[model samples]
Target: MPAFVLLIAALALAFLLSRLLRLLAQFRRIQRIPVSTVALLPGSGQAAVTGNASGAQLSSPFAAIPCVFWSIEVQEYRSNGRSGSWRTVLARTSDAPLVLDDGTGRVQIEPAGAALFLQDRFAAQQGMFGGLNQSTLDALERLGVRTRTWLSTSRRLRIRERQIRHGERVFALGEIARAGAQAALASTPDAPLLLSNRDAPALARDLTMRMLGLLALPLLLLLAALLIGVFG
Candidate 1:
């Protein structure tokens, strides 16, 4: 076996192993923590909670669409007249805190670093000369662009964003506990966060499936490398 070939395979194996380990660790953590209601939890500890999004309605940066949490991605089509691909021009996520109401009480979620998996999403594309709807044109303005100048460029722009709407049930994992009489619940500063539109059980299953796929990569690569060395 060529030393360099073996080295490359080893590096890939290391990366795959790291990812696999991380997935397993995360899964275990999620498993050990039971879901708690906002009204019932220790004063401060890592926990899982299920609730509805409430509090102030979030305004999306690009379209000003109402939501609790949102992610926006804008892409511009680039072409050489013979070949083209959509290129991302702007992407951002909302940092606004949202209230999670579990019927028992409300928990304020600071979603600064939380991973979100929302299914209520939107995506669209528009081009020059009134080729798009009026709403899309108005949305482009909120995203910081002049409608006339944008369409005059003769380039197609794609807008994509997803939101967790108010009154929607969602799962949230973080360090949360009672915050005295003044506040119902609050997330600790150093807690691991996992917020999603899927319920706790379904989200756990999805994570495990993804983890297994990542775990398979290293083994497959190792087997392929061994076969090549033997046959070559």
Candidate 2:
């Protein structure tokens, strides 16, 4: 009995340790990107109307608003035609600006211009197809080439071609947070950083839970082994 209890405690401890290690790894692996501003948009009325018939408020008013401290991964790939480099930055929220790393500096691309750039760049580069889904592709196509044309004339569309490996995470913040973070940036910072979100506590908690679950896997296996030994 004592051995069994000891084993249980050991399993729990192992699980916790595993979870901690995984969380640490994820934290170290995530790459954060900073932006100058963030904007919020109204949630789609159409989605809400179609989503629920109970009038249960298909979407929260805050759903459309962009929050600070969000993240995405930026991937750069060579154009199929070899005309120019193409970049794909994935975000959970579409209301925010695109991130740009210009070697010497980083900037938040205006949403309109960014959309245009993506549209034109994608269209020009053999339909701009990569990891995008049908919905995303449709959205990009609908966005058209007007804004990108304007941006090309104004800003140098020179993006340094770089590879972003799979599973790399990038972080972004709202305009206010970006401004604050920019002011706080020192010369030769170690890792990329973005503005901290006021609501980050919830996200942190969620991430912690995920890490804990990952840690529990080993414990579960051990328990299964113990149960089989006892029953058999």
Estimate the TM-score of every prediction. Answer: 0.69, 0.27
Backbone clash count for every predicted candidate, in the order shown: 0, 2
Candidate 2: tens digits of C-alpha lDDT, residues 1-232: 4899889878877777865775554343232321222222122110000000011112111112222212222234434664755455422222333343323334332222111101011211222342333443344334331213334532112111111111222232222223333311211122222222112343345566777676677679789979989997
Let me know the TM-score candidate 2 reaches against the reference structure.
0.27
- lDDT per model, in order? 0.73, 0.32
- In the order shown, what is each candidate's alpha-carbon RMSD? 5.4, 18.6
Q: After superposition, how far is residue 58 of candidate 1 from its true place, in Å?
A: 2.6
Q: For model 1, name the residue pairs that clash.
A: none
| Least well predicted 10-residue stretch by lDDT in candidate 1 | 182-191
Best TM-score among the predictions, by candidate number: 1
For residues 1-232, write the lDDT of model 1, one tens digit per residue: 6899789878977887877776675577578888898777667667778899975677775556788789877777778889988888777777777778888977777676666656647777777533557777777777775445444654578777888888889888876643345233333444447778888788878889988898777778778868988996
- Candidate 1: list runs displaced more than 4 Å: 1-8, 61-64, 73-91, 123-160, 177-191, 230-232
